[model samples]
Target: MTLRLAFMGTPDFAARSLAEIAAAGHEVVHVFTQPPRRRGRGQSEQKTPVHQLAEVLGIPVSTPASFRDPDVIAHFASLDLDLAAVVAYGQILPQAALYAPRMGCLNLHASLLPRWRGAAPIQRAIMAGDTMTGVQLQQMEAGLDTGPILLSETVRIKDSDTAASLHDRLMEAGALMWPRALAALERGSLEAVSQSSDGVTYARKISSDEARIDWSRSAEELSNHVRGLSPFPGAWFEMPGEKRPVRVKVLLAEPVSGEAAAGPGTVIEGLTVACGEGALRLVRLQREGKGAMDAATFLNGNSLPAGTVLD
Candidate 1:
C-alpha cells in the first residue's frame, strides 16, 4: 500500500524526512523547493540540500517562484498526488495547491503544536527554558501551523541541551514516527485531533539584535540564551576597555551558585561572570571570525584579567 507522495522541503531537517519517506517505499512523485539563491562569500548560487538530493533520486524537482501562476498550479495538479509531506519548507503553500493532493498535506513540525508553532521552534523552546518539547505531524491548513495533530512524540529537555543537539534528536524522532503515521494513513486509521487554543505561542525567527548578551539577566537565563543560539548567530558580548569593543561569542557555559557583589556584566574571576541572580563559568568561547576554543585556551592567547568588566 505504497502512497504516492509529493515531498516539499529545503534544509537538512527536511532532507532527513524526505530520505525516510523514500526508504519507506513511497512513490515520491515530485519535490517542490525554493529556487537556488546566492549564498556564501563568493555569492554564488547554491541549490538547496533537498533539491540536490531529489535530483540524485531522479524525482522531478520544481522551484516555482510563486504557485499563483496558473501554469505552475496546472503542473502540480498533473501529479495527482495522494499526499504531500512538508518539513521546514521555506515558502507558503497556496490554498489552491493545498487541495491538489487527494489526502491533503501533512507537515512534520519541529515543536509540540500549539506551542512554538512558527519559524525557529526548536531554538525558541530551548531559549524559553521549556522542560519538554517534541515533534508533531499535523494536517496543514492556511493558518500558520494552526492545524490538527496527527501524531506526536515528546522528548525531555536536559539542562545541557543545546539547539544543535535537540535538533538532531528531533530529526531522528521525526524519521521514526513518519512511517508509522503513513501506515495509519493507508489503513484509514489516522486520527486528527484539534489543537487546543490555550498554550499557543509563536516562535519568531531569530535575529542579530537578539544575539547580544544582556548580563543583567539571571545566570540560568543567560545560559539558556547562549545555548539556544550556539553554533550559529552566537550570543555575544563586548569586552570593556578594549579599543574596538571586541565581541566574544559564548559557545558553552554552566551556571554556578555564587553570591558575589560584582555588578552585572562584570568579569569576576577572568572565567566567571556575575549575573543578577548567580554566576556562570564560561567553558568555550570564540572571537570574531575565529574558531571556538576552550576558556583556558582563549585566556592564554587573549588576556581578560579579573575585574575587567564586559559590556
Candidate 2:
C-alpha cells in the first residue's frame, strides 16, 4: 500500500531508513530534519545526512527547530500525511504535530523498549556490556521513548561489536523490518504492547568528560568503554612522553590475562595495558590528529616502553 508518510529524522541511520521506505514505494510527501549547522575545520554550513538524502530523492524538506509555532503546526497539518515515521529526529513532537497525521507517529528506536530508551541507545548498550540489543518500532507518545511497541527484533551483541559496527547492523535490521511493520499497520493487525516498567534505564548522551579512559576500571569494563565510543568521541588515555603527553584513542581492545605489577595503566607488553584487574590489549588505536593503526605500528612510530605508565 502506498501510504503518505512524512519522514522525520536527521542522521545517517535515519537517512538509510528513509531510502528504504521510498524504495518500498511509500509516498514521502515531506521530509523533516534539523537545520544545517556549521561543521568541520572550515566551520561552514553542513547539511544533515537526511537532508542530503531527501534532496536526492526530490522530497520537500522542512527544518523547523521546534514545532511550537502555530504556522509550523498549520503547515504540518496541511500535508494530510497518513503517518509520521520518525528516526532520531532530535526533537520532541508537540501534541498538535503528533495528532496532525491520520495514523499518528511511529518511531524507529535503536534499542529494546524500556531499556536504553533515550538519545544514545547504541553506544550505551555496548558500554553497558549488554548480551543482546535490538531495534524497536513504537507508537510515539509524549514521553521519551515511553511508547507501546508495534514491532521489535533482537540481535545478539557480538564480543567484538563496536558502537559503529553495531549501529550499522541495527540500522540495516530496522530497515528490513520496516515493510513488515507497515504491512501490519495497514492491515489493522498491528499489536502494540505496553513497555514494561521494570528494567527501565536511560541511555544518556555521551560526554567528552566521560570519554577519558579510567585505568582503575576492570579490564573488561575498560574494553567495553573503548568499543562503546569507537569511531566517534573515542575513549582515550594520555600517554606521557619526553616532550609532551600524547593523547591516543583506543579504537579496539580485548581483555587478556596479566598481573598489575607497576600499578594500573602500565604498558605491560605489546599494547597490553594493565588495569585494576587483568589487562587490556589494545588492537587498534589512533594518536591525536593521526590515522588509526595496529598496536605494533603505533608502538614502532610512538615509543611505548613496557614500564611506561599512561597518565
Candidate 3:
C-alpha cells in the first residue's frame, strides 16, 4: 500500500529526502515549507530548495507563518495523511498537527541522538573535533529532538572533513536509510529506543562572532575551528596593513609539527603560521569577495611576508 505522506522540509538537505520518498512510490499529499524570504544580492523573495522541488514534482506546497492558525490546521487535517516526514522544516509542529498523521511525524536529524541535538549539528560536530556523527530518523515528541530514535546510521569523521562535505555525505546516507525505516513502519516492526541522558550537547547555530580566528589557541584547536567553519561564514584572521583586517577564509588546512618560537598569529613561512603550541600550513584560502585560490595564488597576489603578524 502506498503510504500517504505529507512532506515537510525547507533546505537542500531536506529536498534530497523528499525526492527519495517520492521515488520510493509513496504518495506525498502535500509539502509544508517555510514562507519564501528575501535572499541574494537583489534581495528578492526566493523559494526554498524544497519548495522549488515540490513545485517541479507537481505537489501542493504550503508556506505558513505559523502552525497555530485554525485554517492551516484544518487544511493540514484535510490531507488525511498517514505520516509526515520532516527534514530541516525550520518550524515547530504543534500537538494537533503531530496527531493528525496516523503514524505520527518522523524527522530526519543530521546528528546522532543524545549528541548535537539542535540546529547546526554538522558544523558543531566538526568544531568540537568529534570522532563520529551520523543521521537519525526520530519520532517527534514536541520536545527539541529529544524523541526516540527510529533508525540511524553512523559515519566516521575524517581528520580533514569540513561541514559542507560532511553534510553532503550525511544527506545521501539519510536518503538510503529512510526507505528501510519506512518499510519497517509499514510492517509494524519498527522499534524506537529512548535517548540516553548522557552525552547530551546542543548544537547552537553558528554565529559570525565565532568565525573570527583566534590564533592564541593551540594549533589543534585552531585547525578544528578552521575546518568546522570552512566553506560558510568561514574562519578568518586579520592581516597587516589596510585599516580593516584582511579577511582570509580558510578552505583547507592541516596540522604540522614545528618548533617555531614565534608568537601565535605570527607568519613564520610563506603559508605557515605559528600557533600557541605548534604550526599549521594553510593549504587553501580565499580573500573576502574573491574566489578560493591555492596557497601559491594567494601568496602571489597578497603575500604575507615573513615575520608579518596576523590575528
Candidate 4:
C-alpha cells in the first residue's frame, strides 16, 4: 500500500528511522524539522540531521517555528497526508496539526510509554538505574506523550551500558520497529492500546548544573550518574591544584568493595575516591580541553595524588 506520509523529527535517532522508513518503500512526502541552529566550537549554523537527510532523499522540508498559526496549520493540512510519524521533533504540535493527517500522528518514543516520557528519556533511565527500557510507537495527542501505544519492544540495560551505547541500540531498535508498524498499518490490523497511567514518570532535560558530580552520594549512585551523562555534557568534578582547580569529566566509573574512612571526595589510591558510602574507581576520564583517556594513562599525565580532595 502506497500511503503518503509526513515525517516530523530532528536529531540522528530520528534521521535513522527516516532512512529506514524510506528504504521500506513508504512515500515520505514531507519532512518537518526544527530550524537550523548554531552549534559546535565555531558556533556556525547547522542543519539538523533529519533536514540534511531529507534533502539527500529529495523530500520537501518545513521548519516552521510553531504550528498554531493558521497559515502554518493550513500548509500542513494541504499536504493531505495519510499519516505523520514524529520522533523527537522537539515542538508541541497544535490540535490542528495533530488532526492534519488521515490517521493522525504516530510517535517513536525512546522509552516505554508511561515511563521516562519526556525530553531526556535515555539519559534519565540510566541515571535512575533502571534495568530495562524500550522503544514505543504511540498515537500522538495534545497531551505530552500521553497517547495510546500501538507497538513496543523492551531492551535490557546492561550494567556496562552508557548513555551513548544505549541510545545507539534504541535507535537501531526503533528503525526496525517502524517497518513492522507500517506493515500492521497496511494490513489494517494495527491496534492502539491505551497507555497505563501507573509508574508514570517524566524524564526532564539534562542540565549542566546537574552534571557536576556530587561526591556526597553513594558510589553506586555516583557511578550511575557518570554513566548516564557519558559522551555528552559529561559528569565532572574539580581537583585542587597549586594555582587553580582543574575540572575533569568522569566518563566511566565502577563501585568497589573497599571502604574509605576519610571524608567524601577524598582521593584514595589509583583513581579511587571515597564517597558518602562505598568507593568508586574512575575507569575512564577526560581533562578539560583534552580527549578522554584510561585511568592509568590519565594518572600518569595528570597530578591527582593520594589524599587530594575533589570538589
Which one is best on TM-score?
A: 4
Error of 3 at 76 (Å): 1.6
Model 1, 273-305: lDDT tens digits are: 988889888999998878899999999888787
Please provide the root mean square deviation of candidate 3 (C-alpha atoms, Å).
1.4
Clashing pairs in 2: none
Q: How far is candidate 1 from the true structure (C-alpha RMSD, Å)?
A: 1.4
**Model 4 whole-model lDDT (C-alpha atoms):** 0.93
Clashes of each: 0, 0, 0, 0
Best by lDDT: 4
**Candidate 3: 10-residue stretch with minimal lDDT:** 238-247
Error of 1 at 109 (Å): 0.6
What are the per-residue Cα lDDT tens digits for candidate 2 across 137-189?
Answer: 99988899998999999999999899999999999999888888887878999
Please give the lDDT score at residue 28 for candidate 4. Answer: 96
Better of 2 and 3 by lDDT: 2
TM-score of each: 0.96, 0.96, 0.96, 0.97
Please list the residue runs of candidate 1 whose C-alpha ends up more than 4 Å from where it truly belongs after superposition.
none
lDDT of 3 by residue, 169-273 (tens): 999999888788888999999999999999999998888878887887778887889888989878888786567777788888877786667988899888899
On residues 70-95, what C-alpha lDDT tens digit does candidate 4 reach at each position? 89889889999999999989998998
Please report how far candidate 4 places residue 27 from its true position, in Å: 0.9
lDDT of each: 0.90, 0.91, 0.90, 0.93
Q: Quote the lDDT for 198 in model 1.
A: 94
